[model samples]
Target chain A: MFQGYTAAELTSIFAMQGFAGLSLFSVFVLMALGLAIIFGQMGVINMAHGEFMILGAYVTYLTSNFFSEHLSSMFSLYFFVAMILAFIAAALLGALVEWVLIRHLYRRPLDTLLATWGLSLILQQGYRTIFGAREVGVTLPDWLMGSYAITDMIEVPVNGLFVMCLTILITIGVYLVMQKSRLGKQTRAVVQNRAMAGAVGINTEKVDRFTFALGCGIAGIAGSAFTMIGSTGPTAGQLYIVDTFLVVVFGGASNLLGTVASAFTISQAQSTMEFFLSGSMAKVLTLLTVVGILMLRPQGLFTLKIRS
Target chain B: MKKLQDFTRNPDAVSFAVLAIVLVFILPTVLEIFRLNLVGKYLTYAYVAIGLVLSWGLGGILSLGQGVFFGLGGYCLAMFLKLEASSPENTAIQSTPGIPDFMDWNQLTALPWFWEPFHSFGFTLFAVIAVPVIFALIIGVAMFKRRVGGVYFAIITQAIAAIMTILIIGQQGYTGGVNGITDLRTLHGWDIRTDEAKYFFYYLNVALLFLVLLVACWITKSKLGRILVAMREREDRVRFSGYDVSNFKIFVFCVAAAFSAIGGAMFTLQVGFMSPSFVGIVPSIEMVIFAAVGGRHSIIGVVYGTLLVNWAKTTFSESFPELWLFAMGALFIGVVMAFPNGLAGLYTSYVKPLIGSIRPLLKERARLYETPDKGGPDMLNRGTAQ
Candidate 1:
């Protein structure tokens, strides 16, 4: 398909597509991180995970509106405030849902899928009622609007770079929390053995609620980052749910490193293919490859060697 | 008197009678042709729900991609009907006289290879059943044999559903795109647009539904059904008992797919179009809700559940579109939390007992005029008399 392209032109195309794929990788990693924590560690299928992410998006939308209206001179700094507020909003709701809906469905994972789906429907409708059904876009501050020319042929969007930076910061923060923090240690203890953790002085329920909240909070941050690249709508969250779930599953549900690796692979393959095939076909091929690989390697790309 | 006792005692017998009365006589006589046609459309979903009862409820295989099979079946029949509708004489003005209109619109001059066999009615009917079953076999074998069950299986099936919808929509010329295969005029020279034809189709749909229901009931009653329930509860134990658990799961999954395929084929015939809208993630999951609301384990309950939920959807969406999602959301939560067994469980627990207590009063009235020798082996009556 690229037979006619000169060597210089081919290199330029690959660089541009590779950069675009990095932006996509950032989104996938953010989405998959939250899902991996909730689904892999907690064993709850939060089908409404996307809706919660959208909740963060809406919160960011509201925060942006507030800053632009009242503090127009300081609007460049609005994104940081929006990200914090979005995390808190999503985490609070996550805690409440864990208490009310998810706790009862802990034993029945399949039922959790259905119930969360229902919850997603309510949340989507709620978003439509409040935000209206039309897709909403945030006004990127002037500094974040333009692209940087890395040579004449390879230009990178400022927002894409910003999103990648945010992803890297958050990913490191999450890694430190999971591996180094006392709460992370307790959370892993509860996941490994609930009754034993409870008996050993850890409040298992509290750990569960916190872990779920933490997962949801990251999703909120992802949503906050999402505004820079894509528009938000009531159903926009849904468009990413299947892909997010696939990434998490394909990466090995419990492995954070695997999630990141798979996200990069999927995003690069898809974005590269997008240059050759139509957009929908690219998506189809990417998803088909993931599912086919999953069928052969049902345990996914990585597995912990823990005996059941 | 013995027969009466047996009728009241056997839940299956009572359910059969109720289903027969509703589908065979009451619905046909009371509903107008248009409403009857709507019921027929709802009944198509009942097939999918019934399939879920076997696959998810019994076999513990929750396939979130039942819509793929449903669409395959619908498109198979739709392809034939479409080919018949777009006869060479009907399309003499087009660049391609024998090809479907969508193909011609896309500037294709020849019929696609896949659509050729669908030109025959016999092949179309065979394809409707065979296609989905074959597809199910492939998916079922791939996943179940590898021990990929539960949420992982569900996510994969869902991905398949998403892929199918995107494929159908993307290949507009071949699959008719988002508009779907519209303007389906006839089925084997019979004009299906008329009210008379609608009435005939309704009966045909109802008859097919009952046949599927009977097959479902038979499966539930058989020894294989016992193993399915066992496998669902403790798959390891079932496997240790010398059964190939994957084969049983595959078998039930295929059976469910076949049932759903029949429903999809009927849906195309009754609704007059086949589209990707009905073959996507949303509709596929909604089909699960029907089974859930009906009592996932109850075959008869799912049929009623499908009708009632779809009816509520139609009425609620018509009257107040904003509130329907709230109601459906509440329904899902309510069903899972409060009534996991669904309406059938409520009926069996509360209503059936109430009826059982009231039945003795009627039996007492009958006993007053009957001789002792005529009582036969009525255990309840015998105990009461003693």
Candidate 2:
């Protein structure tokens, strides 16, 4: 595939594609982080995880609109406010969903899948009703719009760089939250043994609700970052749900670091393949490889040596 | 005659016979030809639901990629039909006279090698069933043998569905691209587009459905069915009992794939086209909904569920496009949360009791006149029956 390119050209091509893959990795890690918590830590298949992300995107959209209209002087700073509101909105709904629906389905993971799918449909329709079916683009502030040129042939967008940095920060934040915090300790206790946790005076139900909300809050942040790279739409979430799930599953569901690693590998492979093959073909190959690998190694790429 | 008597003795068989009569004889006679054809399309989905009743409801294997089998079956049959329709004389104006128009449009001068086998009706018929079963076997053996199942199996299957759809759409020249294989006109020199052919195909589809239903019933009633139920409840217990659980899972998965493939072939015949739209994640999940809503364990209920859901979808989407999604969403949530066993469960728990009480009252009334003297013996017989 690279036979026609000179050595210098190939280097530039690799560099540019590598950067593109980095941005994709950012999105995948951001999306898969939340899923790892929900599906891996909690064993709850939140199929509507994508919809929660979309909620964040829409929130960012609305925030941008509000800032442009009302707070013109601080338009560049609106993104920070939008991200916080998005997290709160998504977290609140996530808590409600956990209480009303997910609590009843803790034992039946597959049923949780179907119920969340239904929830996704409801959310998608709700989005369409409120925002119209058309795709909405958030107006980027001037500071975030341009690209960084690295030599004659390699240029990377500033927004992409920003998303990557944000992904790193969030990833580190989530790791700390899962490993070090009091809520994290309680959540781990609940996941390890719900009955034991409850007996030991930990509020397992409350921990579950909060854990779910935390996962959803991360998804909302992912969605906010998503607006910088792509237009948001009612159905855009559907497009990425399977891919995000694959990243989580391929990474070893409960392993946060594994999620990041798998997302990086998948995104890099897909982006590089896209340079040589058709976009659809690239996606098909990447997903097929992931699924095939999973069939052989169902525990995924990484696993902790803990007894069931 | 003894076999028939034994079948009649089975309650499920008896209910199935009633359903078969209504679908095969009554429905066709009453509904217009177009509506009947629509019913046939819905019945095609019933095939997938029936398969789910076995693989998922019975065997504890939830395959989200049933559409892969369904699409493969449809595409196999459609390839043959397209080949026949694109004969040299029929397509004399095209650059590639004998090849399908899509291939010609894509500037292909010769038919693809894989497409050649589809030219023969016998080969196509074999391929329709074999292809999906073989595909299912590959997937089933790979996953089940490794003890990968439950949500993992569902996710893997979903990924396969996504891959298959993308492949079909990408390889446009060989697979007919996004538009799919269309304009299917004749089947072995017989005009399939005609009204008479539609009626014939509908009956043929119903017959195939019954055959599949009987096979499913046999599987469910056999000792294997008991083992399946056991495995579903507690896999370790079943395994400790010396059953090769993966083998049974693979068998049921293959059977479901075959059933779905047959339905897909029938769908192509009745609908006169096969497309990638039916072979994706959304449609595959929707097929699961049909099974879920119909009481996944009951074959008859699933068929009814498919028809009812599709009918409601058609009516709602036609009249109020926006509301249809909400209704569908509610149906999914309601079925999963409120009525886990679905419509059939509702029938058994609520409706059957009402009927049981009413039937005894009617019997008591009858006993008052004709069988007043024999009431004690009749009550004894009823007690024995219960």
Candidate 3:
């Protein structure tokens, strides 16, 4: 397939596709981070994880609009404000959902999947009702619009760079919270042994809610990042839910580093193949490979030896 | 007469009898052909729901890609019908005559190799069931042998569904793309677009649904069914007891796939088209909800559940399109949280006792009338006791 390209052209193509893959990796990492905390750390499969992300996206959209209307002078910085608002909005909803829907289905992971799917449907419709079923794009500020040439051949878009930086920052924050902080320690304790954690003075339910909310907040930031590269629709969130879940699963659920590594591998493989093959064919190949690998190694790329 | 008596003595006999009467006799009499045909389309989904009841409900294998099998079955039959519909006389204007119209449009001069066997009616019918079962066999062997069950199994199946849809939509020339195989006019020289054909297909679909239901009931009632329930509860114990649990899981998954394929084939015949829309993650999960709503444990309940859900969907979507999703979402949550047993559970918990109470009272009254002096207050006491 690459026989026609000169060596110089091939290098350039690789660089371009690799960059595209990196942007995709950034999105996958963001989405999977939220899912990993909720699904991996908390054992809750929020099928509405994508919806929570969309909630973030929609929040960004509204914030962008509000800035353009009422505070055009501070338009370039509106994205930061949008990201924060998206986090808070998604976190608050996550807390509410955890309280009302997820807490009861702690024992039945399968039931939680179905119930969250239902919740996703309601959220999708709610978005449609408000957003008029149209795909909405956030107006990019001039500062975030252009691309920088790394060479004559390799050019990188500013927004892609921004998203990657955001992903890095958020990933670090999550890692620090989960690995270093007291709350993270408590959350991990709850996950390892709910009864034991509760017996030892940890409020397991409160930890569960906070963990879920934090996960959802990360997803909101992902959605906010998503608006920079792509258009958002009511159903757009659903398109990524399956892939995000796969990323989390392939990373060996409970392992944070595994999620990031799997996301990188998947996104890179997909984007590179997409350059060589048709888009759908590339996706089919990537997913088939993931599924194949998963069958062979059901515990995923990284395994945490936690005895049941 | 002996068989009838035996059947009546069966625990599910009343539910089965009532369903049979309503579906076979009452529905046809009550509904117009259009509505009857809609019921037939909905019954095709009932097949998938029934399959879910076996795989997910009984066997504890929740496959989220039943739609792939369903699509495979539908496409096999649709290919055969498309070929029959696109005879040389039917496509003389095209540059490549006799091949499917979509293929000719894509500049293909000959039928694709996979589509060639579908030219035969027998091959097509056999392939409808065989293809999906074989595919399911492969997937089941791969995942189940590795002991990948629960949510992991579900996510993988869902990925397969996504792959199936993307493949179907991408291979436009070969698979008819997103529009799917359409304008299917006949089956074995009989024009299927006619009112009589619709009625014929409806009855055929209903009969097949019953046959599938009976087979499922047989599986669920046998010792195998008991093992399945045990496996669902504790898979390790079942394995420890000398059963190759993976083999059973594979078997039931394949059976579920076969059932969904039959439903898909019928759906193609009834709807006159097969598309990627029916072969995707959404529809596959929706099929699970159909089984769940009907009472995953109840064979007969899922059929009614499918009908009710589809009926509500059609009516609600037609009237208040926006509210339909909300209603469906609530249904999913409500069924899981408040009514985990679904309609059958509700029926057993509430309706059955009411019926039970009524039956004894009527029986006691009749006995009292027959022997007024002897039966006196004892019959009343017996009725109250029941």
Candidate 4:
């Protein structure tokens, strides 16, 4: 595939493609992080996780419109506000879904999939009804509008950098919340042993609800970042769902590091291959490879040795 | 003679007889050709639903990628039909007269190697069933043998559906692309687009459905069915009892794939085209809803479920298009939460009780019962353990 390109040109191509893959990896990481929490940690397959992300995107859309209309002077700062509101909005809905739908289906993991799928459809239609079916793009502040030339041959979009930076921050936040915080400890307790955790005075129900909401909140943040690089549509969430789930599963559902690693591997492979093959073929090859590897190592790229 | 007596004495005999009457006599007589063809198309989905009842409901192997099998079946027959339709004389206007239209459009001068075998009708028929089943066998063995199942199985299968869609749509030159294998004109020079052919295909579809339903009924009623339920409730116990759990899982998965493929072939015949729209995650999951709404455990019930849901979808989408998805969403939630057993469960729980109250003696003699829901809570608790 690279037969004709000079060595310098090949180096630039690899550098540019690698950056493209890095941005794609950021999106997958954002999407899969929430899924890893909901599905991996809690064993509840929230098929609507994509919808939750889209909810964040929609929230950002609304926020951007609001900011440009009223808070024109602070329009550049609206993204930070939108990201916060997106988290709260998605988290609130996540809590409501847990109370009404997920709590009852916890014992039936597969049914959660179907029910949440239904929820996703309703959410998709709800977005369509409220926001209209056409794809919507958020207005970027002047700072996020330009591309940074890394070298003579390679340039990266500023919004891609913004998203990449946002991903790093949120991933760190998630890591801290999951590993360092008291709430994280309690949530882990509940996940590891619900009955025992309850006996030890951990509000297991509250923890479950909060854990689910937090996962959804992170997805909302991912969505907020999503608006930086791409357009959002009512059905856009559906596009990310299978891929996100694969990331979580391929990472060894319960392993956070695994999710990130798998996301990086999948995104890089796909973007790099896209240069050589058709876009669809690259996707097909990447997914086929992940699925094949998963077949061989069903436990995934990483696994925890905890007894079930 | 004993088997014949068992057939008559079977509790489902009346339900089966009623379904047969409805499909054979009432539907054909009452509905017009267009409406009847629509029903025929809906019944094609019932093939997938029936398969889900076996593999998902009974075997506890929830494959969200049933559409891949359905598409495999569809594309197999479509390849044959496209070959016949692309006979050099039929495509004399094209630059490449003998190849499929899409292939020629993509600037291919010759037929692809894969399309070569589809020219034979006998091979096409064999390939329709064989291809999907073999694919299912590969997936089933790879996953089940490793004890990968439940949600993992569902997710993996869904990914496969996504892959299949991209593959079919990407390889447009070979698979006819997103436009699908259209302008499918004949089967052995029998013009299938005609009303007479529609009627013939409708009846053929109904007969095939009944055959499939009977096979499903036999599977769910046999000792194998008992083992499946047991496996669903407690896999470790089944394995401890020396049963090859993966073998049962693989067998049912293959059976389900075969059923779906048959449905796909019929769909291609009646619908006159096969597209990626039906071979993707959305349609695949929608097919699951068909089985779910009808009562996944009830083989006969899934057909009714398929018809009812499709009928309502058509009517609802036509009149109140916006609310149709809301209704579908509600149906999925309602079926899972309020009535996990679906319409069949509702019948057994509420309607059967009311009928029994009206005639006490008749209830004992003619009661229509399926395998009890002994495994429902058992399976849920098992899920909790996992």
* Candidate lDDT values, in order: 0.91, 0.93, 0.93, 0.92
Candidate 4 lDDT over A1-308, as tens digits, reads: 77888999988888888887877788899989999998877999999999999999999999999999999999999999999999999999999999999999999998999999999999999999999999999999999898899887899888887788888888888999999999999999988888999999999999999999999998998899888767999999899999999999999998899999999899988998899899999999999999999999999999998777
Global lDDT for candidate 4? Answer: 0.92
Q: Which scores better on DockQ, 2 or 3?
A: 3
Clashing pairs for model 2 are none
CAPRI class of candidate 4: medium
Q: Local error of candidate 1 at B100, Å? A: 1.0
DockQ (Cα-based) per candidate? Answer: 0.85, 0.84, 0.88, 0.77
lDDT of 2 by residue, A199-254 (tens): 99999889999999999999999899989888999999998899999999999999
Ranking of models by lDDT: 3, 2, 4, 1
lDDT of 1 by residue, A1-308 (tens): 78889999988888898888887888789989999999998999988888888888888888889999999999999999999999999999999999999999899999999999999999989998999999998888899988899999999888898989989999989989998999999988888999999998998889999999999999998899888778999988898899999999989988898999899889999998899789989999999999999999998897887897
Candidates' chain A TM-scores: 0.98, 0.98, 0.98, 0.98
Question: Could you tell me the lDDT of residue A22 within candidate 2?
Answer: 84
For residue A99, model 3's alpha carbon misses the true position, in angstroms, by 0.9
TM per prediction: 0.97, 0.96, 0.97, 0.95
Which 10 consecutive residues of model 4 chain A have the lowest summed lDDT?
Answer: A18-27
Give the number of colliding residue pairs in candidate 3.
0
The DockQ-based CAPRI class assigned to model 2 is high
lDDT of 2 by residue, B1-386 (tens): 66975885577867888898899889988999989999999999999999999999998899999999999999999999999999999999998799999999999999989998888889999999999999999999999999999999999999899999999999999899999999999988999999999998998999999999999988998999999999999999999999999999999999999999999999999999999999999999999999999998898899999999999999999999999888888888899999999888988999879978896787577566665565455664777778
Residue-level lDDT of model 3, residues A1-308, one tens digit each, is 88989999988888898887877888899999999999998778899999999999999999999999999999999999999999999999999999999999999999999999999999999999999899999999999998989998899988888889889988999999999999999999998888999999999889999999999999999999999878999999999999999999999998999999999999989998999999999999999999889989999999888678
